[model samples]
Target chain A: MSADVLSAYPASQLAIREVGLRDGLQMTARWPSTPKKLEWVDREAAAGVRYFEVGSFLPADKVPRFADVREVIAGVSRHPGAHGIALALNQRGATDALATGVQEITLVISASEAHNAANVRRTQEQSLAEIANVVRLRDEAGSATIINAGIAMAFGCSLSGAVPEDAVLRMIDRCLEAGVDMVGVADTVGYAGPRQVASLCRRIADRLGPLPYVLHLHDTRGTGIANAAAALDAGCRILDASLAGLGGCPFAPGATGNVVIEDLVFLAETMGFSTGIDLGKLVALRDIPAGEMPGEALFGALAKAGPPRAMSWQAARP
Target chain B: MSADVLSAYPASQLAIREVGLRDGLQMTARWPSTPKKLEWVDREAAAGVRYFEVGSFLPADKVPRFADVREVIAGVSRHPGAHGIALALNQRGATDALATGVQEITLVISASEAHNAANVRRTQEQSLAEIANVVRLRDEAGSATIINAGIAMAFGCSLSGAVPEDAVLRMIDRCLEAGVDMVGVADTVGYAGPRQVASLCRRIADRLGPLPYVLHLHDTRGTGIANAAAALDAGCRILDASLAGLGGCPFAPGATGNVVIEDLVFLAETMGFSTGIDLGKLVALRDIPAGEMPGEALFGALAKAGPPRAMSWQAARP
Candidate 1:
């Protein structure tokens, strides 16, 4: 009598990408030192986390927390198994990111015009042009780095209310046309429900065929985990989550962090998906940030309530 | 273009049952007075919440908080459209609940043998016998009260660990045989994920075709809302949730409250289900419990992050 009931989808194919070091630290009042950041990456890498969004390539003056982006990327590169991803909002950031030889660089463009303008002070067309320019710069440099484009507020925008599906799909098409290697659909404001997530992901899958896309979600309104599960049901394999659910959208007021990775791993494993990450080790990493960023709110249920007594990974695995 | 994405299933068929007064207050340090409880019921009823688990019909000396169960039920009955439900652990409680003319009375039998023994000091067999006896008593009295038997730890258990699906199915069969009008499957310790919830619910639906069942979930590990969404996806209509996610299991150590009714209603409405609950009024109800239970912890995301600005009930409704 196995306690686990397996998912209908392929479990081994599920992938949990760590965005805490970058996204989690972005909104913090204080950030860990470069060494501490590297240790965070190394510990998580040792715990079987293979993908990490290490930091952003924005100007050090504008976002001082990510000033050590190059150093962090260098540290992550040392781990042969781990792939380092950095966010690059414009061509300058993308160029700087490519210079560091980062494994992956993600560019973001909002589906809602209002959110896009508020977030990056640029229109959707301008952001699309920046994405196209970044692609050209990457090709010219002949970098093997993966170029990923994330459509922020893809579900619905806080600033601009309802973001039409056509607008999001069109942006994805333009990003694909711009030669990005992959695309990510983000519920930047945590405004999506499971049904909307599944519906959009299904449409993306139908449109892309085999092209990979990531589901970047925020748990601001508590639908994050549910939306992640819905995405998995709709054939999404790649997901972006923060450790302890740290991070928030500056433009999306009252927004919380990305979905908690520790809980997400628990969810994926229990749902019969093999995240290949050890839950105990991943949960332990919370202490590092807690010690460094004191007074900052840390969120996760697995941290408070240990895994179910009957939770057996071997039984859950396919 | 409507921002709302409708669920494939019937939206109007969904029902969100409030269990805050009964289950939420069960583990609280202090509970509101009978008048306050009635006021809570009235306000929620005004917000279109028709189903409420008012209180448990246990001995006042043992559980003093529910001493005014009769008063609460009577007050709830005053609302023309509202249906009041009370929990009855044994024959005495069931009889008392029936005598009050309550609309519904629920009997609980844990699928986990150890949980049954620990919680009620009775074996599974003994609980089943009690259920049968209560059914006989109701018939003799010519009561029209709906008898719902909940299979506690239906997903998994803290005391006994894994609760076998076969064991739960067997319990449901016995309860139905014992003349229960409806059934509920409870994740007593929050030891469930969406996949497991959907799996068990699908099995139960298959075995008891068209028989209405309720999903009683706990947000113990942050998977409650996700599990609720999965239940809806699996054709479950009625769901049990607590206001501000108050409540915990004394037997299941470290368990949190039931799924937040405000968040669940938000989830239901946003997922295109017409719960008929006014999200604004429902959310405002959080203040009542917060003000009454001063230092007690209350939980919900929608309460903190106001509804998505574009959340239009007209658009969400099918």
Candidate 2:
């Protein structure tokens, strides 16, 4: 791990990008309505969550949950400091997303060819070409939307096991060459442990220099928060999580959900790092999803057992 | 983290002491029969788990699951390399446990006074005095069984939250003064995170010098494996885990179970440390518990998703 890169991070701050609206809602059979989603954004932004993956730009017929991406983006615009991000797979989605005046767009490509084919029905190379086209489209449109290239299945794939580190590095190079502002590595199927997460993050940080790399982890194997801690120790700062751990792999049904953002906030706060999230308020919002989608399994430890009473979030951070 | 202590650990070795028979069965309403427990011991021993906490020397009326502790000890004696350990809270239990010819006896005392009283109806001072009495009895009886003082709620307590670090260290000093061969720390109510676990373990290691320290973690907050990883990184080697993540806190109902031995084994193995336990064998034994208690919640991701295909225990270790 490079001390320089680590030092570059705010000594007391960590950024948590909430993906519950995008990654979480897509897996649900029944999801929050557009009005409910907008309410969620408003409540979350008011609760001090700065980054929200509000929705994904995709075919409405395929994913009805994200059909109101434009409305959701418009709702997010009311908040001054809240940065709303949306996902786009190609030029069409990017063009549509830009029209909504969203600030950031994430272009995703799977490191595993099989996963890419299964997820988007395109090869890794084809997905990269499409991502490049999206980047060109964003640049040509003179949109200030930041393009963050997300390398899904960066660790290993459910369909194709043992994605080589070299393959992930090569994809990073391609994403960088194609004009991505930042790169994010994801364990799409959550097949990683702490050691693997730490080793890969360190290698990526060493190679990427100062370019920000995010770790998007799933808690499938129950090692997500552990892996996140390992990634932080290895100097990879940005992380992606969902509220109440509300996501699952549509392909692998019973796998665990994404790392719970509430627990992640507790972890960061407990570790003495400042995440501006109000733990009490963030945990309280879990009831919205739970009430709306009854019988949906919500996961998090901090919610079950309150944070340690010794450390007051306000006093410790301030 | 002390690099020297971590490097000093036998490069390829880690010790996992299975506490399922004592901890898991105690919480279970309907547990395996005496013969079934002996079979579990034998099978686990055959599968390369060397240390087994077979039972506790508590009254049969209180915990019917451990009524056959003597028989279990005799059964474990048949396995040449497998070491059998049992819990003893007082001199009477210690004497009885020694009479059973067990290889080791663990004397437990809670770091919090409230928890100590709630658990055993004794104060910390009373428990410490009883432990001292047990040490004297063991030495007077010419017993060779190893004595380990397990400090429960060393991190925090459910009955009494915020167990000060000073209190834990004071208890450790008292336990050492009481003539125990080794000392173990436990998150009896599972209120600890990785940072706390690491800091406590590092402090314990620094204070104890050459004395061995063990970490007994519960998965109540889903940070169990992460805590285990942090302990390993902090130079603590011995760990206690229950098979299939069984065992709940009788005090704090609805709290999560113990750290699953199978998942801990996976974490250790993935981090390049060798725990001779067989993943397939450990996972298969989960069925024994699940079958006996039909509605029991058996947890572990490895059992559901299987180990990563790239790393073979046979090839990686051998």
TM-scores for every candidate against the unseen true structure:
0.93, 0.90
Which 10 consecutive positions of candidate 1 chain B have the poorest summed lDDT? B1-10
CAPRI accuracy category, model 1: acceptable
Worst 10 residues of 2 chain A by lDDT: A1-10
lDDT of the structure predicted as candidate 2 = 0.80
lDDT for model 1 comes to 0.83
TM-score of structure candidate 1: 0.93
- Candidate number achieving the greatest DockQ relative to the actual structure: 1
Spell out the clash pairs found in candidate 1.
none
* Residue B262 lDDT, candidate 2, scale 0-100: 84
Those runs of model 1 whose alpha carbons end farther than 4 Å from true positions after fitting are: A1-12, A249-255, A313-318, B1-12, B249-255, B313-318
Per-residue lDDT of B1-318 in model 1, one digit per residue for the tens?
Answer: 111111211245787889999999988889988888988999999999888998998889999999999999988899886788899988999989999988888899998788899889999889989998988888889877888898898888777667777878888999988888778899987878898888888999999886668889988888999999999999888899988888975644445679989889888877888787888898888878888888777777777777777776225311
lDDT of 1 at B168: 83
Candidate 2: residue A256 lDDT (0-100): 61
Instruction: Choose the strongest candidate by lDDT.
Output: 1
Candidate 2's TM-score on the B chain: 0.92
Could you list the iRMS of every candidate?
3.9, 5.0
* Positional deviation of residue B149's Cα in model 1 after best superposition, in angstroms: 0.5
- Model 1: per-residue lDDT, tens digit, A77-153? 88886788899988888999999988788998888788889889998888888888888898889777788888898
